[model samples]
Target: MAENVVIEINNLAKYFPITSGLFFKKKVAEVKAVDGVSFAIHRGETLGLVGESGCGKTTVGKCVLQLYRATSGEVIFEGKNLCDLNENQLRPLRRKLQVVFQDPYDSLNPRFTAADIIGEPLQINSDIRGSDFDRRIAELLDIVGLAPYMADRYPHEFSGGQRQRLGVARALALQPEFIVCDEPLSALDVSIQAQIINLLDDLQDKFGIAYLFISHDLSVVRHMSDRVGVMYLGKMMELSERDEIYKSPLHPYTQALLSAVPIPDPAVEEKRKVIVLKGEVPSPINPPSGCVFHPRCPKAFDDCSKLIPQLKDAGSGHEVACLLYKTSWP
Candidate 1:
């Protein structure tokens, strides 16, 4: 791993067992939610993960945070392999890693006041209490653009955007080095989405926090990410710098995904070739042989159905997994 890398994932896999029986439930099959995914997040840089629902984007984030124990492979945080650590061993390191879930309404505890919600982490991780804790809560509220007076109110009192901002404040309360933002803006209004995105940018600039921003919105991902990784059927199809991936997508899946992002100009949108992918995503439990994306890929060749392609560098830090680019990668 690089010296500046905050998180490094190597061949990470998470499988959920499917069982069926009358009296004795035997393991029927395993759903390969995340299969052989690898990537690294550097300090202060945002890595955007974009994929359709059930593509295991959320599973990857949870695995990195150790919320879900990986079925195989390593999640290396800083220099330590998180998969090797037990719950007790991981407790101290929890403060360094955090997550902001997709639904702000569901994530925030209604029973607790805003001050208590943000202050809880501080209480658990440190000894700050009394006036110091209150001060810290007020500071966090200010950082997330919420008024200090709102601290005494409950989550129900705030609007959707304000609630999401409160969630951000709580995530930052512990001063984490890395955060997994799991579709943080998907639930908010279009107007509010920009505000949260800008707030995240400002927070990153001030705190030097690295983010694994997971979303299905390509436009938002392109704006916030320094680099982007595209996944399909639990496998990473491509990984490259944001502009590189957007401008010259190497994988068939990536190309199709980017083509679907609506152009701003009416003329440009009409002129552009829309690559509409046919067929539904394959079941993870019984994914197609060889390349998982072969079933729906318009450009898939004979080799795509017979041999699985390994992700390798195509050049200039662009990594792609596809038979077409096999010769380009060494």
Candidate 2:
């Protein structure tokens, strides 16, 4: 796995400044969107990051994509720390690190036709123009399950699923090594969701593209990811192989999250016990001391409120952050 790693993140953290006063605004506090989170994505492997809304799943993706500069920590991609590079230094690497946002329409320009939208990346990054550009556009559309004829149509003219396909095509235009899928299925219908999932799966198989798949949907993550990492309040609760984590979650937070996902079988669903967490998520500006999840964690101990646990491996590459486990990890 070490040799196969395409990207490595070490103690990654992103803190958004919170200020007061409109004109003379000054940094008062910070929203710790990502705090000391660390993980790696292997070549052609999809790493799923799942969490409740505002728990920093998207922030982690942004940090990996270098869309959001980290306050501290390393995001090593292509042998350089992305957070350390300026826009000029990072421009050449942009094509290799593409992203497919949650909202298809919002991420795309309504004024531009589908052809122009997909061709924009090519137009700026590549010297391919005229007939060559046209052929590339058609090829990309076909690759994403869209017809070449639909290239001339506007985003509004296409259905939701088609627009998403269009988004996927644009991401593929650069033939990137890695792609950040930021809740790409959240805005689509359930039926449409499956199509997109399969499309992404097929694309990865064909191109060997690594993906940092961020979503709130547990089932989709389970299906798409080789490994899954569960996050809560800007900290990772657990990380493991998909089957192992789902079958035997070490963290209480992970247990709660998996319990919430409904089983398809009636007999299994009827017998399954749902873990209903208590209280609402605390504010990021004033997060609780020690373990951020202790407030809602059912198995939280007295030390959980005073001692923050670092992610420690609990055998076979499964890592968890909880005071209940007495282990050391570096």
Question: Which candidate gets the maximum lDDT versus the true structure?
Answer: 1
User: TM per model?
Assistant: 0.98, 0.98
The residue pairs in collision within model 2 are: none
Q: Write down the TM-score for model 2.
A: 0.98
User: What shift in Å separates residue 324 of candidate 2 from its native position after superposition?
Assistant: 1.4
Clash pairs for candidate 1: none
- For all candidates in order, the CA lDDT equals 0.94, 0.92
RMSD versus native structure for model 1 = 1.3
Cα lDDT tens digits for candidate 1, 1-330: 888999999999999999999899999999999999999999999999999999999999999999999999999986799999999999999999999999998999899999989998998899998898889999999999999999999999999999999999999999999999999999999999999999999999999999999999999999999999999999998999999999899999999998988989999899888899999999999999988999999998888888888888999999999989864322
How would you encode candidate 2's per-residue C-alpha lDDT over 144-217 as one tens digit per residue? 99999999999999999999999999999999999999999999999999999999999999999999999999
Candidate 2 accuracy as lDDT? 0.92
Indicate the residue-level lDDT of 223 in model 1. Answer: 92
Model 2 misplaced regions, further than 4 Å: 328-330
